[model samples]
Target: MTDPNEVDFAHTDAADRKRREKATGLARYIWERDISGAELLDLPDAQLRKLAREAGVNPPSTRETWTVVAELLDEKSRWAAAHPGHPQATPTHSDEKIMWIKRPITPWT
Candidate 1:
């Protein structure tokens, strides 16, 4: 006989895990590409919601896509200001990208 509480807890845990995975995937997508605000605007609401979650914006369910994009960009700018040395903190210009390519890659432990 399984306890109902345990089953509910297990379901909640699974959902949380799934949400985390989606957020991670979205973050990776953003990091690997130079995505513009227009591109983000084209994304579905569900994807924007996931990106909002990853950006720590916590956009309301009733918010429009443009509103969410604005918030995400604002949060990204704040993060870049706070962590200027981080690789993905800001978008690199072509010259900067060349410089980045010339720099040696450090392996993470």
Candidate 2:
């Protein structure tokens, strides 16, 4: 059996990968929904953190634009969950959407 005290670098690596996946997922969701980061900035810090948690990612204690986007998505998700009876409100925000697009989409182009 492996020593209990021995740290598992593999496990740590896996966890890091998971966190990155969650962060990426959160970013994609935000973009698809067209939620505004500025609106997320309007929410309280606790609420912002809540969004990160709901997204299965840990947000930094300090605020950031990506965190704000995650928070906005979480807020909308919570609202939808709370009001299942109500028709889902359009998530499209009037404010400009934050662009977090990854580079090198079309290498051949």
Candidate 3:
């Protein structure tokens, strides 16, 4: 079945692609910098806000920033698959389920 969410992102509008790239860059900073755990608690409000913006997060509060981070990561993982009818990312459900494919299926699968 054709998934409605499926799209040839390579052919998508350039602006959208750029925005996604930017957002992902910001999301990476949060994880790659190793500040996710500490900043979520100890940082002052102003610095936290700055970090969030640099991470391309746009939300009213730090908690909401997580959603933006998630969106960027999710979008990034999607590109691993250039086509549909297969998983792009194993995103955690609200229950934090681990649902990603550990090993890719063979073409014969």
Candidate 4:
């Protein structure tokens, strides 16, 4: 029988592993699409607002693009700081092709 005082290292390790996995996934999603603060500025206002909502900044104080951009950048910086050592996946040609295929078809495309 296991002692009640014994700590479960396996459970602790598993939780840590899961957290790292999530962080790595976030890092990949950010890097793969080049979704940085500066790049976000090039996006349409509608898309910027959508991103703000997704970033948890609901009903941003102002509709100004810069405001939302700053908030999103701050959120990204905070996540990076919290998840140190998260893997940044290097995108290959195949990855680029897949991204191209998945990209939304715009009137300009």
Candidate 5:
């Protein structure tokens, strides 16, 4: 059985393909910056809800990491298309600190 949410990019129209490419590019940018969906999971519920709103996606009742990532990607893709010249925000100092603290401490010092 096929998954309802699965995107068949191959057969999609040019506009759809471009949209997917933009979203994929957005994901790639985040990953390149060492930003993982796990960091988003650390966000408070209200923040997640706000992210969903900004992304133009209906916030899910359950705060699932993947769902949040998907919604964020969707919003970012649309936002990028709308503002091609705008600079993308990198992980802030606080964001990096949170990720660093969340990492497992190693015994080798």
Candidate 6:
């Protein structure tokens, strides 16, 4: 036998929780932050798992970690060794995404 007032309050509380969850470090935030599967580069397997946990992403196994790491490290190496005229290495496809990602708009948006 819940009162109408209590039910309304519970609904409001649930709505607030969802809003915060969506706005927090969700998958979209991780992607837009330029943190991709490519970030495992050069990091040890343990470190990679720890980093993934920190970033709210599920970690991969050693083999997968090495695969991603190799690609990223190769890119970094190529970029570092390239002459001034060489095309700059792109760490991630989304490297420039942060600037263009639309953030949570104000009520005006």
- In candidate 5 the C-alpha lDDT for residue 74 amounts to 55
- Judging by lDDT, tell me the better candidate of 4 and 5: 5
- The number of the candidate with the highest lDDT is 2
Candidate no. 5 TM-score: 0.32
Collision count of model 5: 0
Clash list (residue pairs), candidate 1 = none
lDDT of 2 by residue, 1-109 (tens): 9999999763587855655566566654554445545555665777656656755667644554456456656666667668867755444442434332223467675
In model 5, the runs with Cα more than 4 Å from the true position are 1-35, 65-109
What value does the lDDT take at residue 63 in candidate 4?
37
The estimated TM-scores of all candidates read: 0.35, 0.35, 0.30, 0.31, 0.32, 0.30
Displacement of the residue 92 alpha carbon in candidate 2, Å: 10
The C-alpha local distance difference test score for the whole of candidate 3 amounts to: 0.48
Candidate 5, residue 29: Cα displacement in angstroms equals 11
Q: Rate residue 41 of model 5 by lDDT.
A: 64
* CA lDDT for candidate 5: 0.52
In model 4, where do residues sit more than 4 Å from their true spots? 1-34, 61-68, 71-109
How far off is residue 94 in model 4, in Å? 15
lDDT of each model, Cα atoms only? 0.52, 0.56, 0.48, 0.48, 0.52, 0.46
lDDT of 4 by residue, 1-109 (tens): 9999999763587855654444344333434444555554555677645544543444333334343444555566667667767753232223543322245668875
Clashing pairs in 2: none
- On the 0 to 100 scale, the lDDT of residue 37 in model 1 is 45
Model 3 clash pairs?
Answer: none
Tens-place lDDT per residue, model 6, 1-109, is: 8776565642476755644443233333344344433443534567646655755655543353345334544444555458545544333345654443335667965
Candidate 3 segments whose C-alpha is farther than 4 A from its true place: 1-27, 59-109
Instruction: Put down candidate 5 lDDT per residue, 1-109, tens digits, no spaces.
Output: 9999998764468745555554454444443334445565666787656544544555545543344455665565566568767665333233534432257688996
Model 4 quality (TM-score): 0.31
